[model samples]
Target: MATKRPRRQAVSTCPCGLAETYEGCCGRFHRDEAAAPTAEALMRSRYSAFVRRDEPYLLRTWHPRTRPGRLDLDPGMRWTGLEILATTDGTPFHTTGTVTFRASFRGGTLHERSRFERVDGAWVYVDGDFPAA
Candidate 1:
């Protein structure tokens, strides 16, 4: 019997340990065509956005009703890693979804469960609850 080869996670390309290209992984969400399959994907893409300093894309993906008036990333803060615990949907094809993640920051760490909604053929981040740091 032949054994299947193990899949490799891309360490160089993605901040997350997924054996996929940046373009194939989080970049898809930034692009207009591809839709995230789950909340984890969305969360990963969002993390990548922070790394890439793509605030515009962040705003684009954010749910407008709950979106802040402006987007600003801390200048000195360095994002270390991302750990997604669970997800609901958060895909382009879904109506509603949730993503729970632990993101490491320089000042401290952030653990949040973000909610997303798809309305009128667009996916947007709605809200999130964070644990006390």
Candidate 2:
């Protein structure tokens, strides 16, 4: 069937700079209501799942042994900026944390250092580091 792509509303509040928006920042982790308190809010919800290309919410917010069972994610590359270069609090945040960011994708541009996990207390997305320039 493959016909379902219309559920995005909370627009223009967090394009991944994180001042809080997109329905009060990442729409509380896409309406799960809170989770992602750092690594720039899971790099602003992985740049809002690459600006709403979603891809099963970027493979269910990844982190399953570096998740990658199936993902083509090719919709014309178009996420153009973010730079949060520095943070440390992986292995359960001390009140939550993470930052290291440099997402500017087009044909190729990746430099991450993401790893966030707070689970029961919120904050998810527990692994990342795409450095191979």
Candidate 3:
């Protein structure tokens, strides 16, 4: 028989640049308790997933066409914060959307315009383009 691991305790603050505590914010989406209601929300949750190094959550929310077979996250990379710069058409009423943001790490920032699509009534990450500096 295999032993099941205990659930991780929730953290105090969310790393997605949100004011809510982790459990009250992105944790719900990470745990599959709720789907992100908008493209920007999903983008925020994905950023939080990177901060927490939640590879499974990242994979699960990725679009089938774009999802990689696996992720190779740097265990030593320190994710600092996120800034949502813009959004387009990513609402409950829209099936497609885009989110532009900057994610800062210890050494630098990542600026991207990410595309998303609704798959089976759930939002999934399609891909992203790195904007020119």
Q: Which candidate number would show the highest lDDT if scored against the true structure? A: 3
Residue 12 error, candidate 1, Å: 2.2
TM-score of each: 0.78, 0.29, 0.90
Worst 10 residues of 1 by lDDT: 10-19
Q: Could you give candidate 3's per-residue lDDT for residues 1-133 as a string of tens digits?
A: 9999999986678889888998989999999999999999999999999999999999999999989999999999999999999999999999999999999999999999999999999999999999996
What is the C-alpha lDDT profile of model 2 across 1-133, one tens digit per residue? 8999999875566777767767777766766676665556666776787777777766776666667887887787788777777777743437555667777767656787777655556555667667665
Q: In angstroms, give how far residue 9 of model 3 lies from its true place.
A: 12
Enumerate residue pairs that collide in model 1.
9-19, 10-18, 10-19, 63-125
Task: Give the Cα-based TM-score of candidate 3 against the true structure.
Answer: 0.90
Residue 24 displacement (Å), model 3: 0.7
Whole-model lDDT for model 3 versus the true structure? 0.95
Clashing pairs in model 2, backbone N/Cα/C closer than 3 A: 21-25, 35-123, 36-123, 39-98
Error of 3 at 105 (Å): 0.2
| Candidate 3 Cα misplacement greater than 4 A, ranges | 1-11
**Best-performing candidate as measured by TM-score:** 3
| Error in Å for residue 119 of model 3 | 0.3
What's the true lDDT of residue 57 in model 2? 68
